[model samples]
Target: MELDPKALALFKEGYDKIIEGIKTLGFDVTDENFADTAARAAKGLHELIHDQTQVRKDVDALLAKTFPAKYTEMVISKHNTCFGVCPHHLLPVIYRISMAYIPTEKVLGLSKLSRLARLIARGPRLQEDLTHELADLLHVNLASQGSAVYIEGLHMCMAARGVGAHEARLVTSGVRGVFLELATREEFIKLVVAPPTTLV
Candidate 1:
């Protein structure tokens, strides 16, 4: 994707300031090895936060591809992995998402579910909010009878700072429609927690 010239200029200004800050920390910015550090960092961050509009357009296109389903069985997709930035700290968050939905008359393609999980995870966002957004998209956009999302997130802010709980993982869930039923919720939990089968 091409970067907007205005945004690139702004990012370059920010990187210049960041280079000055690095100098205060006693880093030799003039060093040959560090010469391009600021530019590389700015480019990396731009990739993470830019092109959100394109991502949304891709999501809309994905949602448009659906097939008719006469049955009401639940569809589950597990271990959809994605990376995101935490808005609070600008740190990375690793996510493993599992989703389930009971289709009414239409259902998204199986691969689309995983793609949707990754698409929604782009950019800076909170884990709790991300979980709910996935559930809402499936339930409302697809008009599913019910939708649920379970996420396991490893937040760099939690692991690299403050209390520094390196082993800690934040787990969050969201449910809509029929998934609010006790039995249905429990079944989703059971399936999500079950160990993956080993190939012979």
Candidate 2:
């Protein structure tokens, strides 16, 4: 479904059409608050259509730097903030992501791990995909002995559009390697949901 020349020609016109459509429903497009809504919506939709492609990771240099060295340590990147819209309803989904992997021979710079999460998450996405992708890459790309990713999000899709029920939360996670095994998974869950009390 490529955009033909005819459609491309009407791109700006289409934006005006949306403004008019909203106006017809008794909304004021001329208001300052609505100044950039159309452009923002356009960008969000554009991102949704391009979900399959991302800034791919090149691991050659990093692998050369860290792999074949057999270093296993729990590398955790926590409290990475994410802002994205849901593909289904274009609703806002915001969350904090905590990702950890027990690296085996290869380790990424902590910032790079956060970069990977943001790369996969920028476009329109599902909570399930967001969480699982972080875990999957940490497991597969780094060849981690264990990997875990947890996401806690408030999805406006269900609250504002679907049934207008607010305050609903969506949590999704993915585990691989030792994180997939029994005892490790249990510990990970405990840490995610109920961290042990520590005196600071």
Candidate 3:
């Protein structure tokens, strides 16, 4: 298959390091297995570190929509799951996102919210950056009066290493515009925290 010259070069460098690193760890990287093992390791690392700019653009084109002169109301989406690589350890961080917005002249389809969340969470990322970026994207792209995002993440970097408490989770939130209002913000918070029957 055709490949980018620069990327191929970088992959080779990484692949070489993988073989050497394993050999240094007291395991014999034999000639027979060396090529295959390095190729696999390099491919995995490239996938984890690849740029996601195109993915973001494609998701925006697929999802973002605007309509003329619409009434304003709170829009909320909950339980959107995100599987991302933690930049620090290259481990998975599982995220559940809940978001709310008040539309100005635009609103996104319900399914698109989940798509957007998924697209943004795919590469090496920090939960805080992911939450802030999602909120910002919604606020601008939806032309909304306000936007709020809440994220709860189980970081494998934390769970699998360091203190190693698997049950520990990190929660983060971001809000802009009318969501800054005490009551408006609380309304969004309550919706996420309350059971489905409360809203139904």
Give the lowest summed-lDDT range of ten residues in model 1: 1-10
lDDT per residue for candidate 3 within 125-183, as digits (tens), equals 88999999989888877778999999989998888876758888899999998999999
Candidate 1 residue lDDT tens string, 1-200: 45656666677788889889988999988889777676777777666565778788988999999999977899999878888889998888889899999999899989999989888886789999999999999999999999999999999999888575988989999999999999999999999977667769
Which ranges of candidate 2 are over 4 A from the true structure? 1-15, 30-37, 40-54, 57-71, 161-164, 194-200
Model 3: residues with Cα > 4 Å off, grouped in runs: 1-16, 27-37, 41-50, 67-71, 194-200
Q: Considering every candidate listed, which one attains the maximal lDDT?
A: 1
User: What RMSD, rounded to one decimal, does every model reach?
Assistant: 2.0, 5.1, 4.0
CA error at residue 191 for candidate 2, angstroms: 2.7
How high is the CA lDDT of each candidate model?
Answer: 0.88, 0.69, 0.79
The sequence of per-residue lDDT tens digits that candidate 2 reaches over residues 1-200 is 13234333344456768898989999978899888666655554454333332244333333344445355756777767777778887667777777888977777776876666655666567889888877877888777787999887877777666564577778788999988787877777676665434658
* Model 1 steric clash pairs: none
- TM-score versus the correct structure, for each prediction: 0.90, 0.74, 0.78
What global local distance difference test value does model 1 have? Answer: 0.88
